[model samples]
Structure formats: C-alpha cells, structure tokens
Target: MRGTAAADRQSRPGRRALVAADLSMLRGPVSGVVVLPNRLVWAPAPAGRFDLDDPFDRLRVYEIVLREAVHEAELRRWLNGAVLVEVWPHLYLPRGVRQAWEAIHPQLAVVPAR
Candidate 1:
C-alpha cells in the first residue's frame, strides 16, 4: 500500500498532504511546501511569497497574502519577474525548507535579484 501510494504521488504532478510521511516529504528538500497548523500547502513561485517583489523583505506580509488568496491573482503579480514553476503544494513552505531545496536545486535558471 505504501509503495502504491508513493508511486501515485510520484506520478502525479502534485499530491495532497494526507499522511505524516508524505507531509514530511512536503517538508523535505522541495521548494514551495507550506505548512499550517492543520494542513500542508504548496504553490508555485509566482503563486506565493516567492512572487513577492521583494522576497527578502516583508516575508511575513507575503505569507499572510498567500493564506488569503486561493487562486492566481497574487501569483500573476510576480509572474513577470519570477519563473513559473509547478504549483504543487498552494502556499509558502518554511524558510529552512526553501533554503534547503534551493541548496540542492541551485536554480539552473538565474533570476535577477531585486
């Protein structure tokens, strides 16, 4: 059952955070996994704080915006300057997770720092 579930998750473009282990993977070295008190969320770069005009500054504010928006308006704002990656999990993940993911991924495509 675990193997089947894992395979299903791997095959799907995105999977819901239904299990603790899967939630852990959501916390793993993968960009854009947002974890709230009760659920896990993931959003592509432009979809969440990753789309902020200034990601380094006002991070908390951006996070608040992400929790509020259920669609792409917020993301669209940042699309011009940000890369459109997979909108996997619908919110921003923790800072450590994002940092770790970036370390391993090393963004092959360069994004000009504002």
Candidate 2:
C-alpha cells in the first residue's frame, strides 16, 4: 500500500485507541489483539521454541515478526476487522529513548501491555 491508498487505509474511521489500562483488564495471558473503535478481539502469537537473550534484540525481532505477519495482503485481509495490539514492555523502549524514537517515527505510539 502506498500514497493515497495507504493514507486511506490508515485514515479509516474504524481505528480505535488501545491504552495501557485496557490491557490490564484482560483476564488471561494474551499476546495481542485486534482492535476497532468499540471492540477488542484477542489473537495470540505462537510461542517460540527458544527464549531470546538480549532485550533490545528481542524487541527488534518482535517488530520484525509483527511486520512480517501483518505486511502481506492475505494477512491484511485477515486483519480487516481490527488493528493489531502492539504490546508494551516488549515493543516499547525506555522513556527517553521512546521520545527520541517517536521524534524519528512520529506514527509510533506506546501503550501499556499489562
């Protein structure tokens, strides 16, 4: 997706805000969820066979994994009804670092992952 189409896709009115508090309210262990203006649908990621050692590297890997999962047209089609929940602590960097990251990538926002 690019230019007008990309903008249109992102600008769609169904977009919803998922705050940190909402994540805490979830009952069970959830990897993530698909979000809409008024609803949240949980969809967990599969567990890996091994654990990651480095924290920074882990976050980068998670971002890449999410991008890969969400980039394809078929996956996007599957995601049509909701927006992906970006888990905090993992996806979120430290406070000062996060501010700097946002300075470079304005579209990025951090929300609590409970």
How does candidate 1 score on lDDT? 0.29
Per-residue C-alpha lDDT of model 2 across residues 1-114, encoded as one tens digit per residue: 310112222111442211111222223212233222111123334333212344444444333333323223322332211122443335633334334324433444554455
TM for candidate 1 is 0.22
Off by over 4 Å in 1: 1-57, 78-114
- lDDT tens string, model 1, 50-109? 323334423533334333322233333222212222331222554333333333334512
Cα lDDT listed for each candidate: 0.29, 0.30
Worst 10 residues of 1 by lDDT: 16-25
TM-score (all chains, Cα) for each model:
0.22, 0.24
